[model samples]
Target: MTVVEADGSFVEPFVTKNLYINSGETYSVLVKADQNSSRNYWITTNAIKAHHDFVQAPPPISDRVIVLLNTQNLINGYPHWSGNNRSLSLPHTPYLIALKYNVTEAFDQNPPPDTNDIESYDIYDVSENKNAISSNSIYRIGFNTTVDFILQNANTVKPNHSETHTWHMHGQEFWILGYGSGKFDKVHDTKSYNLINPIMRNTVPLYPYGWTALRFRADNPGVWLFHCHIEFHFYMGMGIVFEAGLEKVGTLPTSIMGCGKTKDMIRP
Candidate 1:
């Protein structure tokens, strides 16, 4: 298949034998069936993505660059997924209204760590639970600031087991910089990023024991969720919230407010 577009945006045509598409992610590909007419042919599909098969460019230098690690761990004998040591739980309050009206008590503004301590924490260790912290914090980003995020996949609590994660962002579509296997080397991996024709995508996949690099601008105003598209994964706490320039979003109508703390706003 030859991919002509990705995530609703046109990209340099990418030809591949097997391609993986995640939820909220769209791709257009062309297939040529030139096989034997008398023989049966089957196209094989897998979870593997072509890492070095395209030429692309990321946005200009980001104001802030961060690397985050996601892991599936056992907490109190139950399974939960976390990003940067923080397991996310959806809050009842409307984060958009909270940020707009200075409702500090509505959500925690302490963001998750940018990166995990990979040196002390073994990426291959599954012997016991290592990270399990519950949080409903909203990561704040400056308006119009360019951001680069590197999502690193890690081992779960099961022996030799790691699952794939599909990360979907709200409010902004990002450029896929590159993909890498094994531990992500900041210095070496940064050198391998595609800065000529990077594909713009709202959702991207992360393979087990691998990493995916993405870049986007925080131009939107309001609260947006960045999470695994997998329903179960997100339900089990695999997501994070971002608040970007809420002041620029202006006041919210009663339609999207009054959930938790929007009652205090002066409404018409």
Candidate 2:
């Protein structure tokens, strides 16, 4: 197939047999079905990958760089996925309501660290990870600030291997700068970023024992979610919350109320 567009935007055409279409992702491709017209051909929509060629997106520069460690450990005796050594324990109150109402008590302020603290962690090692903790944390970003995010995939507690995950972000699209295998070397890897025409996407895949880099501008208002798109993985706590420019936002629609503290805002 000759690929032409990604996520609804046209790209410099490229050819490949395997394609990694992450969740919330769309592509337009041209397949030459000239071969074997006598029999039906099977089309693969599963995940693999091919780098894109063009898109109007943020340059490969950012005001801040946040490295997120993707790992798993036993949280309360069950295997759980986590980011930056913390599994997200969301509060009953939707984060948008909590942030808008200044309800400090509604959610924990524990934001996932921007960097991984585990020194010399082996990506292939299947040993038990003991440093993880669960919390109702969320991240606050300065509106319009550009951020470069690097995802480092790591080993888990029970499985003798790491797993690939499809990461999705709400409220904004990001420029996928590049992807790498093994531990990410900030100094060396930064040079490989595609500054010319990196594609814009809301979701991308993190290869097992590999890394994926993305850059986005937090120009949107309100709270957004950044998480593993896999249903089971997200349920296992592989995600984080983001809030930016809330002061600029006006009253949310009344339809958004009636949960947690918002119940009071929606009276009879």
Candidate 3:
């Protein structure tokens, strides 16, 4: 049996029996949703619970590129790094958040929304990394180097925990830029954020309940993973892909036209 909201977004409703809640008992409940199906469900002691507020969908993962963000346990004391039943081999980034993406439309102009976006977290850098990309080709870090992303808060009942959210990347280091806490704006664009001096690093922090911008070069080519560092948040589905150093393949003269980048690493 499952509990569901009146609107039917989640699987289960808010009744006492529907939500496996023990009054006065402070216990952590593991909330879950279906990764493949539209029916969102959570696991409980008595049965597999469902709710209407939550949506069951697969988190976003871009095969063309790889993105990894550490959301859930950013602090040094989290179990992902210190406890016996450790969750991660590497230290979680400064912040973590849940996210989702469509396999087909992930790179499209408009994307779907999840509960985590109601308030976004982000960070940016402007300093360029000299060794960010190793390549034989000559590409300057002038206009060719820039990175930015946006987050949408579609949830009405945003989580009431920390007001700050941080985001970080993996593999190639990037420069910090600027960030905001609203929808995409054209006038206040972050395309040329810190066009002056740029910092370099693989990880950047995104603020809670807001959006962030960044700039980097597509110098490295390979499959790099980008997702929320928070194991729980990552499991919740906040991730993306970045494909740099991709080599473009030519098509035959017959008509089987095709174009793609080489999946090889390029360092300057």
lDDT of each residue in 58-165, candidate 2, tens digit only: 754788888888988777778788888889877888888888888888888756678875457777786445556887888889999998889999887755688989
Give the winner by TM-score. 2
Write candidate 3's Cα lDDT for 148-238 as tens digits.
4443221111233223333455656555555555443435654435555555555655554354555555455433455456555444334
The root-mean-square deviation over C-alpha atoms between each candidate and the true structure, in angstroms, is 9.0, 8.7, 21.9
Query: How many clashes does the backbone of model 3 have?
Result: 83
Among all windows of 10 consecutive residues in model 2, the one with the lowest summed lDDT is 46-55
| Residue 267 Cα positional deviation in candidate 3, in Å, after optimal superposition | 34
Show pairs that collide, candidate 1: 56-196, 56-197, 56-198, 57-195, 57-196, 57-197, 57-198
Question: What is candidate 3's CA lDDT for residue 201?
Answer: 55
| TM-score on alpha carbons, each prediction | 0.76, 0.77, 0.36
Each model's lDDT: 0.82, 0.84, 0.34
- Pitting candidate 2 against candidate 3, the one with the higher TM-score is 2
